[model samples]
Target chain A: MTTDDQIIRNIISGEQHAFRVLVNEYEDLVFTMCYRILAHRHLAEEAAQDVFVKVYRKLHLFDQRSSLKTWIYRIAYRTAIDHQRKKRVRTIELEKAPMVADSQDDAQVLMERSDEQQRIRRGLAQLKTIDATLINLYYMEGQSMEEISEITKLSKSNVKVRLHRARHKLAEILSRKQMEAT
Target chain B: MKNWESDIWRYLASELMGTELESFEQALKDDPILADKYESAQRLKRNLKDFPRLSPNEGFANRVMQKLPAGLNRNLWVQKLNRKPAWYFLGGAVLLVVVTLSIGWPQGSAASSDMDWTQIWQWSTQLPLSFVCLISAVFVLLLIDRVVTR
Candidate 1:
């Protein structure tokens, strides 16, 4: 298992295959970010490809000051946002949850996961992309505030404040949605 | 005590440490509302994780890799040109146009009324339109290449 720094060094030092390792590692993460932002699988896939290509071009520009995950995430987020703007697709309310883990999980767990996903998707749909993204990164991805601040290019204080507000808003939206559903 | 919201968030985010964390834990044990908020946040966090895990299609990495220029393979001229932006191609096109106009304008301007129809025909053929056409064709090819490649 090569360290991220080693992989980065190898890529920069003219080992082209080193980049494939990076793509394999962060590809799902980039795709998820793009999917959450774009809400379209086709567009998200396209955005993910663009993000990887951009990462290759900018690999030489990356200083080792930050973690490669943070750098790639920032690229993913920015790329997704750019695609969302260009397409201007209307955010649709999620009607049914796809059970990606249905085969692996017991029925009860799958049910909870499906319900939870639906509620979260609804909450996200109600919020702006950045707000939803902040909550997604902090909670879903388990990113620290400092790491998220770097990815967002926001001050630590600002990231913390905004994250709280976003969560609170999401909670409110979820509560409202449950009320209506009930 | 100053900003309990920060404390509550830090506690939920697992960012609280030592004394601050100890005090918050005590508060959570004592206050029902605070504990309820904590419970709500925990539920939210767990549910958030279930939002979705979207992975690209199977051949996604290969497609992206194919699109990526052979960065380390600098020996490949196509890779070298592929790395340049569409703006560079556009600039090359504009430069070609300038050179063509500069060469064509002088000779075309000199062909006046004294030149017969056949002379006019000769002058038109004398202009470097073929070279200009070739350059323009290459420019269009580059533009199409950039759009398609991206």
Candidate 2:
């Protein structure tokens, strides 16, 4: 396995093909993180691509103070947030913006596979971006509060408090959805 | 339902420490309702953990690789220049002093032990042209880098 430092050095030294190793390694992680925040497959894909482009441009500034993955996660989080903000602005301009249709069938198929998972996703989608991201970082990725704090630039206490509230909110949403279904 | 909901999440996260963890465990054993809530929270956690990770559509990596700008290597040089400009300036200054000293004072001006205004004027005139040439050379190199990378 080529180490991250080696891959970085190779890319910096003008071997662009070496970048494929990096893209391959982090694509799923970056895509999943983006998807969790954006909640649309096509938008998430676009955001993930944006993240890689930013990473490539800024790779020279990576000082190695933090692990490569954490740095990339921070970039991914910020990029997705930026995309979400731009998306919100565009929706406002359009007024009565169309629903994101690309991912609906994929989401429906996945929901059919597991009702509870879909319920959780619905609950997550309703939460604030920060809260949902915290939940994804905590439960889905199993990141510790400290790691989440570093990635999100929130204080440790803030990550804990938000995560606690996020879980309760998710539970409330899930119970309400269940009641509706019954 | 109660404030213990926060405690349940903390405990699930394994963030509750020492006495806090102990107390939560004790409460879990004592209160049937709390125990039931804990069970459900645990189930929710399991579902979240098991949630499938979504991959981007096929050839996602290829798409990303294709979209990567070809100018990154040239940008890296620009970034390096932006990061440590002092070194380049110092090198230029040293080169300027060496070139000036190597030209040696005009032989007649030095022998006469006089300030030769005409000699000084000629040297000063040549200095600006040399500086301009140096800057143009740098600009041309940058232009070449940009074109080649593109």
- For candidate 1, list the clashing residue pairs, or say none: none
Q: What is the TM-score of each candidate against the true structure?
A: 0.63, 0.67
True contacts kept of each: 0.54, 0.54
Cα lDDT, model 1, residue A110: 44
Name model 2 segments beyond 4 Å from true: A89-113, B1-6, B10-36, B75-82, B86-150
Q: For residues A1-182, what per-residue lDDT tens digits would candidate 2 score against the true structure?
A: 43999998888877777788899899988998998787666788999999998888778778787778888999999999999898862212211323343334465335424757656776787788899889898888877777898899999998878887888777777767767998
The superposed Cα distance between candidate 2 and the true structure at residue B65, in angstroms, equals 1.5
Model 1: per-residue lDDT, tens digit, B50-116? 5556677778889988988755544133334443454576667667766755654435546665656
- Measured against the true two-chain complex, the DockQ scores of the candidates, in the order shown, are 0.23, 0.27
Interface RMSD of each: 6.3, 5.0
Residue-level lDDT for A161 in candidate 2: 80
CAPRI accuracy category, model 2: acceptable
DockQ of candidate 2 against the true complex: 0.27
Global fold similarity of model 1 (TM-score): 0.63
